[model samples]
Target: MLVGAASMIDSVRTWLRPDPIAERQVDPVGFAGTATVAATDYFAWDQEDKPSRTTALDRIAEPGADIDGWNGAGKQRVDGVAVLDVNRFARELAVVTVQVHVIPFTKPAAPSQPGGLKASWTALPARWLTAAIPVRSLPGGRFALSGRPALVGQGHSADLGNDAATEPPDADFSADTTVVVSKLLTAYGTGDLEFVRAAGAGFLGLDGAAELAELDEWRVAPKADNSGVRIGTATVRWRLPGDATLACTYRIAISDRDGIWLLSAITVDAGGPR
Candidate 1:
């Protein structure tokens, strides 16, 4: 009886006629493809490319049947679609990180249904699996992961070079260093490129290479509060574009250059030094 009911529901869904109201609501620009889904690519939103919201759909449809003729063009029907706003998602993750404890984890062999003429996670009379992935970002520097079996099986390949120093700095620049680190991360969270540009300077960021670090939610604490000689430590996550993120805790040294505090030395967590 349950199987019969399920089959009946499937048949109903397949036989149902398309909704004209819903068809009118489809966005041509967004429908262009994944490249435009991020909205960061110029081709996705270029005025010349998107003459009307439905230009792509209209072009292939029969002249008189504007909205009703795409099927005649032999294109498969679409069920549902969505776009991810990664930046907004990142912000939301940030908030969640501050509000809760998130234990990092990874899950493999997760299940799914496949689809399309080509092979995919949902494509069959099959039991397929995949890994967990991030789907959205949260507030206070947090992000969430989602899994689709279709995206499984792909392996990552990249090399991380190393050259950072290994020793913690002398315990003399704690307060100033803490303030600098705080400001740097705050500016990074807000995407303030200018501030980030300045912070990447010799005395602000440990290395002059400040732009390399992205995913910036972090914690900083003073190792010693000797007033005259302050030492601090921080654990940070760096999300490099198209690369694996690296987690490390490092130390810093602040200097007084004519009254203004500036960072002068940095020691990345090199396994040898905690």
Candidate 2:
């Protein structure tokens, strides 16, 4: 019978797959604080604590979640939550998202006819929304709320900047690769790893964690497949701690050795593409 129907379709596809390291042994930061306290008690409420906010959304949703279709007219609060993204989907599902902030819950505008005289305003402009939730996981690593928390919408814009690999003829570095990127950003702003191992850098310097304050622009390219590397791109300026500054741009690599140049590697270009 055609080799017993291909060995019972390979034992029903190994009992319907799943366990390819069950979603890489999950750990979306252990359910981002149970999806930020179940989307902050699923977008709070307060019509005089509607029965303890319906007993905190029936102790974190999912037992027939409709989230008690709020009949208790307006009023929310939150004022801060966070999380912002998790997704997952296996080793016990996941979703997360978050953001929040809210505020609403106004009261104080009436006064059009009677003893006209009120307009003091009490609240209702704050905003930031976003939500999502879903969660699940449990069994020690903990997390729950498996449903109700929709809202969402805020994330649209993608170009992945390649603007012709940062335009222009640019790509000529040999003035000792601009003095080894200005003494590796002045020994990465003074935490000087022995002047970056006497400028041959094997890595490790931003030890002072930033204070350079200026070296504001640079560029080089030539690594089409390494002719002894080259790739730079600088553009710095740190300062901070009140004396404010912060510019940043890094993307180095340099290397040349023997004919010296060194500095090896760096990162933080943080734009799209290359």
Candidate 3:
């Protein structure tokens, strides 16, 4: 009974062709051998004087001038040709080192995928993952020392129709260096204070007000007496001069948001006394 029902459904589908008339038309440009060429006849030539040919061959091979006979044509000696010496050639060369630092506002959770997930699944959320660090300027120092900040975590997605299963999320930071300082300074000097504040707060890990205040060499400290907000001496060892390097350190403190202070970012300086 099931087979008969399936056959009836198939018949109905076959009858519903959208362009039945167009499908029935035949093509006019059919394949066929239309024309042929005739074969031609061949002819042979008589041989030349054998004694003259022998004498000519003997004269040609008389000495080193034509020692190899007629076949030794256009051979000459080449001198001082330039070529690459294998020992002197450089191969696949690269130098210097790179380091990256990241600090999360909140600790990242483990990856989870919910559902009978397919291998081709792709989805990314639209949000900003932020980290905060410290920035300081020395007394009478024109430049400020900015630390690194980043998002170092993964995300997960739940399975369709089943809330229990989830998929993994990829996490990364947008800005990873202190070069943004020049732009931030320009924004501040031009009275685009909000832009300056936002850029400093996001990149240097300072609060909006703190970022504004720090424009004039303000001091930074922990909220409470015992909270550890002050980051001590940060020594940057130069591997290569005028190259960017990143480092980070964290401390606990009491504040409006759990007092967990995270500091991160890349620093560049004029190769200090060495």
| Maximum-TM-score candidate | 2
lDDT (C-alpha, whole model) for all candidates: 0.28, 0.56, 0.21
| TM-score pick, better of 2 and 3 | 2
Writing each residue's lDDT as its tens digit, candidate 1 over 64-129 gives 321210111111111222232211122211100000111121221342335424322111121211
Kindly list the per-residue Cα lDDT of model 2 for residues 156-181, writing each as its tens digit: 11111223236552546533366567
Provide the RMSD of all predictions against the true structure, rounded to 1 decimal: 22.9, 17.6, 36.2
Worst 10 residues of 1 by lDDT: 93-102
Highest lDDT, which number? 2
lDDT of 1: 0.28
Q: Candidate 2 deviates by what RMSD?
A: 17.6
Greater-lDDT candidate between 1 and 2 = 2
Q: Mind giving the per-residue lDDT tens digits that candidate 3 earns over 67-134?
A: 11111111111111111111100111110111112111221133233674423312222222222211
For every model shown, the clashing-pair count is 25, 0, 18
Q: What TM-score fits each model?
A: 0.25, 0.27, 0.14
Off by over 4 Å in 1: 1-177, 184-231, 242-244, 272-274
The positional error of residue 26 in candidate 3, measured at the CA in angstroms, is: 87
